[model samples]
Target: MIRFALILTSLLGLGITCQAADKQDLSLLTRTAEQFARRQLADSDAKITARKLDPNLSLPACDSLEAYLPPNGRLSGRSTVGVRCARDGWSINVTLDIQLFSQAVVASRAIRAGEVIQATDVQLQRVEIGQLPSPPLGSIDQALGKTPVVGIGQGIPLRADMLRAPAVIQPGQSVRILVNGDGFQVSGEGKALGQAALGQSVSIRTNNGQVVTGVVTGVGQVTVTP
Candidate 1:
């Protein structure tokens, strides 16, 4: 009976040892996945959660595990990191949750649509770039002289597609027209017949009532080339 009890105790010790080894292996796998995520993300701040393998789950023993991102895998949001044995002996998908943050331009106060964005209208703020539908503007001055397509509330991040340059010439406004020829340049005043943004075409009626078309070059300015 004494001999049998000693054998049972020995077996229990071996079982615990095996469990500890398995746990360590799993921990190494998680750490590998996290390092892979950090390198791929390259963001200032990120929260990466690696898959949790069941302690009792049956898995093939792999001495060399490698982590990789699947083809076209997203860097953030819901995604997965694949871990496989270096010899293709076993593979598993380690799911991940990654959140990336960035600093971008945001409105400092309520901005009305069609109002030119001034220096005081925007400010830099932290935002989750991953969650946004489009990339936000990089700086506050990027929005200067631009008008929003729609009114934005205070603290809303600004996107490049959200703002447009205001019209440089308004209807019936006085404009300076520069006519360019091969060797001659002439400047005259005209009444703009329509509104136009910079680089757009507009019609102007000169002082002599002659109508001419030119490209809007700057505020209250247009240019016609021979």
Candidate 2:
């Protein structure tokens, strides 16, 4: 009977050791998630944070933990991160809250319609990328010399669709038209039939009474390939 008791005690001790090894600490999983997020999203401007796991939530400690995103998954906005153990066939999906922040150009003051944007007309502000109604303008260079399509309020974020290149050549004005051929280039005076911005298309009536469409290359200048 003594030999039987010794065998039973040895079996019980082994079972306890296996159970302890199989149980994983929650802290390990959270730390792994945080590290994975920062590495994968290193190129992005947004900050990444891993939420705490529930203390009551029980999970087997995985021998190997693999973190991955679902197919067609994005790092922005609401996303899910999957942590799985291939050997144990157990996995956990952690819901992540992603916030994207970026710097954008905003109007420095009230800007009137058709007013040309200047260096002092705009400033940069840090804002959430997803909240903008349109694509945010990132630099003063993009807004400089561009005219607003409509009046804009002070402190409002500037968008590309909100502004445009000011009309440099107006209708009823005289323009120099350049015609380029295989071997030569010729210049002629023409009357513009429509207003045009830089690099925009304009219709011009040459002095010879020929109406031709050309690309506006500069102020009061249009170019045509003949």
Candidate 3:
């Protein structure tokens, strides 16, 4: 009787060990599914849920340890039979794509594909949309064109040969001059001879035949001295 009781107890312990191993395998499957869902489907602030498939529906066959055992019938006892967990692992499979948007205003005008766009360009477009004021026209260079000419006096007769034509002057013109007994002075008036652009050098002849060279500064001004 004592030997029989001991044998029964040993069998019970073996059964408990087998049940624990099965539970561990099931837990592993659940964890793997969760990881897949987190990585593929709900990466953003979006929500995600999953469902397992039923075991009766085309479950994978689990391998039995007996297949590897010798014909002598010694049991290896390794088995692979299992229930289908969560769509058999299909619910965790997912794909994600992200899109971005800008808050900046765009031009109402038609935009060509592949054209590089900038903030200033967008602002100009917005002007057409009447979302913002029209950009100011005629940059400083344009304003300089409309500038008036300054006058030179004190009987300092301009040199006819050196007399840079007044037409050479434009708004905001300047020039350098070596005056009669006055040393060097830069002077010129509007457009440095009207409509003259910046950086153009012209010859100015003083009353005493002194030749001076200068750049247009304003509509009627030129710096001749320096």
Winner on TM-score (1 vs 3): 1
> Model 1: which residue pairs collide?
none
- Compared with the true structure, all predictions reach lDDT values of 0.86, 0.85, 0.34
TM-score of each: 0.74, 0.74, 0.22
Candidate 1 regions with alpha-carbon error over 4 angstroms: 19-24, 54-56, 171-195, 199-216, 220-226
Q: Least accurate stretch of 10 residues (summed lDDT) in model 2?
A: 126-135
User: What's the alpha carbon RMSD for model 3?
Assistant: 24.7
Candidate 2 accuracy as lDDT: 0.85
lDDT tens per residue, model 2, 1-226: 9999999999999999998777877777766666677688777677766677787877888778988887887677677788888879787777667777778999999999999888998999987775456779898899999999999999888898898898889999999999999999999999999989998899999999999999999999999886
* Per-residue lDDT of model 3, residues 1-226, tens digit only: 9999999999999997876554423333433444443443343332323234333333232322111112342111221122233323422121212221112233223333333333222221111211122322212222121212233222211111211222555333443342223654433222223354445666555445555566555444455544
Native-structure RMSD, model 2: 4.3
Prediction-by-prediction clash tally: 0, 0, 74
lDDT, model 1, position 214: 98
lDDT of 3 at 139: 24
